[model samples]
Target: MNTTRTVRLGLPILLLAATAGLVAAPAAEARSLPTYTCGYTLDQPQFDSVRGRECTASAGAPLIGHHWITFQMRNSGSGETWVCNSVEAALVPYYLDNKIDPDYADFERAYGRGADASVCHRLLD
Candidate 1:
């Protein structure tokens, strides 16, 4: 009779311990932000080549996007400074606050007037 009672109580404790482990796994991963890679390539009338690769931790909602946005330019002759070239390999994308960013257009326009993306160190939202 005592053994039966002990088993009943131990079973619930075992189940509770298993549940806690499962929940903690995701929480630990969430605490550590995942890193992502972003590529940089530039093309213009004078120069065209793959600049380099960059690393970011953005969650893909606010700033991280397909096109790498330019925050600063390198002062190229034709304004295609290829700023992203000199920027740090690891950078944080600009947050848009879920609204239209005038600087987004400015960055695109300053690089080379490229319809898709410009040369810089940032990514699209």
Candidate 2:
């Protein structure tokens, strides 16, 4: 006598899938707050990094381009070299606005004297 045997594993598979759905999802990780510190470099790469130290909405301040320039003669007609600040904000012709640049009274006026004064003057050059 020839006979055919049928295996009915579909119910077991369905139960396994249903159990998987009942599992709780892994907890989501919290996003980290921005790292704040006094100016770490004479040349702050981005204007937002400067504002980051101030704890203000980035949009509230104008985004500007900048670079550091070491004044060979700052005070005493200066030292070997000293005084580095992101002074190029005044020189940047255009950015997102693509219009006239903000007429900063001076380099220190670009961000505000407080931030400009925080520039890291000494570093392992």
Candidate 3:
């Protein structure tokens, strides 16, 4: 199928699964939450494994662009952190509309793993 057609059809399903994953998500409750960060790198040409994009930004910065998105849920108390999958889903359209190029391949790839918690970052206050 064409890229646009594929995106039109697949995006809704991906969003639905991603949303379902969030409803059961645990609430953020702790005295101090660790700060987490995440990101992914494309498999470079002639490369073995993916590199860490280590996506970081100012707090409250909108993730609206064509590029990989990562969520790092860090523990402000102990410096521990993890990823939050729901936030990742909520950020997809932004990435697709702003970050992914006309090729649409990257958008598709991000959508493929859209439900993986490994890609989310939840910031605790």
List ranges where model 2 is wrong by over 4 Å. Answer: 1-23, 40-106, 109-125
Q: Encode model 2's per-residue lDDT on 1-125: one tens digit a residue.
A: 12222224566677788888777566689743211122222333353222221212122222244545422112212122224444333212233354365444343333432233234343233
TM per prediction:
0.27, 0.21, 0.21
In terms of TM-score, which candidate is strongest? 1
| Per-model CA lDDT versus the true structure | 0.38, 0.33, 0.42
- Kindly give the stretch of ten consecutive residues in candidate 3 with the minimal lDDT sum: 43-52
lDDT per residue (tens digit) for residues 1-125 in model 1: 99999999999999999999988775444442222233333444244222323322234312333444333322223333333322222233433355475575434423422222233333232
| lDDT (Cα) of model 3 | 0.42
Of 1 and 3, the candidate ranking higher by lDDT: 3
Shift in Å, residue 70, candidate 2: 33
**How would you encode candidate 3's per-residue C-alpha lDDT over 51-110 as one tens digit per residue?**
222444345533433334444443233444454332332233434556545455455445
**Which candidate ranks first by lDDT, i.e. highest?**
3
lDDT of 2: 0.33
